[model samples]
Target: MIPVQRVPVSDRTQVLLTRWTGRVRDAGGTPKAAREQWIKAQTPRKHVRTALESMTRGAVRCMYCDDSRGTDIDHFQPLENAPLRAFEWSNHLLACSYCNSNAKRSQYPVNGDGVCLLVDPCAEDPADHLRLLLKSGLYDPVDKSARGEETIRVFGLNRPDLVKGRQDAFFRACSNMRDWHRLHQDADPLADRLAQALLDSPFIDVVHAMTRLKPVAEATVVGPATIPALAAWRTAHSLSFRVGQPRVRRSAASTDCIDGVADNALASDARSGQVRTGRRNNDEPVISMQNYGLTWTDITGTPRSSAVAYDESSAQDRKADLVNDGCTNVEIVAVRPGKLPEPRG
Candidate 1:
């Protein structure tokens, strides 16, 4: 599962959700009743689904498996126990029917502190808790107590079909990385193409794990110790790989970017009072092929926007397909690197 940015919902939608939650609360009914009321409301349901789909880049891939198209709105906290959060936006996640109905039906387990055992992809980094075995395309928990083990079991992440998909992604990513490395010494344009291809590869999480890069995150700053290899590559290539290099005071609560960014562009943590090293921040460059117009926000809240196609012929073929499908614009942007932050002292 990849990290998804929770975009802001419209005021109209927020108001509708609030009204429904208030109704459920006023009735003091069971979660079943709350769900029944929510299901009956056509407008609010549509708005919520749309907002969740947007988080998935219109592909609506399941937040759990990252393989199938998401067909249900999953409650990160089951509405059965957390009834009051029935309509809470943060509690909602896009999920495929198999992961939702077949595997994780009302199975909300908590640890000793009442903290959830499941990994909320939006709230935590799945990579920290999970690792991908490239050969088998199976997910294993990074540690015994890691939440990924439970998440994988609960979500059926290692099911045969999902494993196959991850396997394909892993092979593609490895091939592209090798190609990039081969062209590196030659200063070949194909190397750049290979990098973009890796960025847009399916099962992006696998690609990230193989490359040791973090996915996108809530914050832009990253530390050198987090991604030493990637930092070294960026330095050798003289490429800036960060999203944005804002110099604001860092807070203790912030997390590193999930998507990779260039080194040293992050602000220093005021709590730690250390001047982190300096590196360039290269924002993500996008290559979109959508039926509708591209409308999405970036880490910098900038409007607008790749794959491995370094040659003109292959690039043209992809662009042609987009144009035939009614895509009007074709823009290519740079990508940044990111790594998990070190624990604060």
Candidate 2:
């Protein structure tokens, strides 16, 4: 299982959910009964499903297995017991029918302290509680008290099919990383394609392991310096190396400026007496030229920045340019006219 970040739901959807729950309360039925009743309603049901799909970034893979498509919405706390939270957004998670109906059907066990035994993938990092056995393609609890054991047993995470799938994903990711290392410089286009494939592949934990293990030296075509270059690339593109979670998407204002080309250019212009400022009237709107730059990390932990643009649209254009150049985790931020605060050295 991987960690999933929750996306904000639209107010319209929130109102619909609130109204549905209110109707359930008015009927005086159990939460489970209410769920059954409401799920049969086509419009609201579709809205909830569409919202869930968007939250999962359109992959809509089962939160428990990450292997199968999520076909149903599973209540984190069983509706029979926690009726009040039945329609709570935080309590709903996408699950495959197998994991929902067959494996974890209404089983909500608690520990001695009354803490729930199941791992909440959204609230907790699964890697902290579970460790993947690369050789066996099986999941094991990090320790005896870790909730991973109960989660795996309840969700059937180590089932034969899942184990086999994980193994295949692991091998495929390793092979691709090796190819990426070999062709990154001479055949960059192909390498970028391989990088994107690795990014989009299921079971990203396996891909992250490949980067950490640095096993590309075993490839017959690799050289002594390949490991360092690979490491550098990985550092530059830390966003791509993230395992067990979706890539972090920062707002344009919060994104880091990688290259200083725009800043340096503006500084050079100022030094060369190219910049001029004047106010025609007290209330005249300032027409200062603002520059925006596209910034993103590569596979390695290096910061990359683009040339400055005169407007936000130009910044978006620069972002597209980076995308066309095979960049991932790209963002456009204002770099000049109104310079963003710089990080303390």
User: What does candidate 1 score on TM?
Assistant: 0.59
lDDT for 259 (candidate 2): 21
Q: How many residue pairs clash in each candidate at the backbone level?
A: 26, 14
Model 1 C-alpha lDDT per residue in residues 193-299, reported as the tens digit of each score: 56654555457666545445443520122223333334323323221122223422221112243113212323222223222111101223211111111122222
Best by lDDT: 2
* Candidate 1: worst-modelled 10 consecutive residues by lDDT: 286-295
Q: What are the per-residue Cα lDDT tens digits for candidate 2 across 1-345?
A: 766544334334444455556667776758666777566545556655665565442256787888778999888888787765565556778899999999999999898898999987766667778877765688889876458889989999999998998899866655666677676545243554466556556666554444444364333323344455546345433222122232222112111211222445445544564322221113222222334445675545455654222244445654564566566777766553213323221
TM-score of each predicted structure versus truth: 0.59, 0.64
For each candidate in turn, give its C-alpha RMSD to the true structure in angstroms: 15.9, 16.0
Q: What is the C-alpha lDDT of each candidate?
A: 0.55, 0.58
Best by TM-score: 2
